[model samples]
Target: MRTSSSALFGLGLVMAVDRLVFQPDRPISDVQQTLLGIVRRVART
Candidate 1:
């Protein structure tokens, strides 16, 4: 249960960072884009 909660917290944190830092006008590195894509896929599932 604790692990699950921590995982959820981490996901939420990632999502928050995605929205705050990855704006349309801003450019991101390839690694950052890949990480964001992975996070988005996981979020959809």
Candidate 2:
């Protein structure tokens, strides 16, 4: 259940690319809101 530094770095890269990728139908605020919701849910568990 332990996460390594590389795994964390990879996750960060993925999230960064996900945020940087252009989407005509989606906005940055929506993406941020979704990420925040996920963080909140995980924090509750």
CA RMSD, predictions in order: 6.7, 3.8
Best by lDDT: 1
Q: Model 2 shows how many backbone clashes?
A: 0
Which digits, one per residue and each the tens of the lDDT, describe model 1 over residues 1-45?
687568767866775577567764544464467656776776687
Model 2's alpha-carbon lDDT is 0.64
TM-score, one value per model: 0.49, 0.52
Superposed by TM-score, candidate 2 places the C-alpha of residue 17 at a distance from the truth, in angstroms, of 1.8
Stretches off by above 4 angstroms in model 1 are: 24-45
Cα error, residue 24 of model 1, in Å, equals: 6.8
Q: Which ranges in model 2 have alpha carbons more than 4 Å from their true place? A: 1-12, 22-25
